[model samples]
Target: MIKNNNIDNIGGMEFATFRLKEGVTETRLVELSHQVEAEFLSQQEELILHFLVRGTDGVYADVAIASSQEKAEEYCQQWLRNKVALEYLELLDKESVNMTFWSKIN
Candidate 1:
């Protein structure tokens, strides 16, 4: 779930953290991430870069950079409802989910 939804005037970045669900492998997550990129993220006009990262503690992070804060917020809200996005989300431990958006500063 989203932890903060604060908006800023500049472009922003999305930092979403979660743990993989039981039986979910990193390979599978990576494969599905590609699908989400193709079908969902790539469609966003202001999206700059979207990538997945894993921590030593097993927590995973989904990082997305957008050209504008408004577009970032818009994409985040819309992605939650996208079928491909939902499929990717299913790999994560639901209770571990936390998303925060950070706006770029001068």
Candidate 2:
């Protein structure tokens, strides 16, 4: 059975945070985001993603996957295989280190 959406200590959540590059219009960005969420991310039940883009500040996402860091990395790679999806965001740091964090609902 599928587990609840809320994150807990038992299910260690890994985060994949990224940012949007300049010149992508808000309308295009949102459209691409919805498509990615529904078509790509939703297909993977092992993943839970939170795409955050408020105003014009920046584009960020907190991706919580139900498995190891390697799986999380694989998921990220798969999500980017879409050409349209690739235009929406970029890694905040090309040299950033990957880390795992716990997620939970208050």
Candidate 3:
């Protein structure tokens, strides 16, 4: 599963956070990160993002990104060998979260 939240312009760059499944390996994650970074560089898009992979056993891996979602998903597909499914959750920005702290948090 993947959770995404859009953050308002930070230094004129967009930001998002993703929560992913834990089955992915460190090597694959790094490869994906590099691919995404390359895509952002090619497109001249400023991206600030991070991913947290939650394992069934509760362990997690964090991957930081500065790229586009298209590139990220492409890497995700490749990492899963085109066999696993991914889910995305909409996330509010930090200001939005603070504004509605009483609401069910993501």
TM-score leader: 1
Quote the lDDT for 85 in model 2. 53
Better of 2 and 3 by TM-score: 2
Clashing pairs in 3: 2-87
lDDT string for model 1 (10-98, tens) is 37888999999999999999999999888888777677778899998899999887876667778989977999889888999999999
Each model's lDDT: 0.82, 0.53, 0.35
Write the number of the candidate with greater lDDT, choosing between 2 and 3.
2
Ranking by TM-score: 1, 2, 3
Give residue 25's lDDT in candidate 2 (0 to 100): 59
lDDT of 2: 0.53
Q: Which stretches of model 3 miss by more than 4 angstroms?
A: 1-10, 45-106
Q: Give the TM-score of candidate 3.
A: 0.29
Q: List the RMSD of every prediction in angstroms.
A: 6.2, 5.2, 11.8
lDDT of 1: 0.82
Q: For model 2, what is the error of residue 63's alpha carbon versus the real structure, in angstroms, after optimal superposition?
A: 3.5
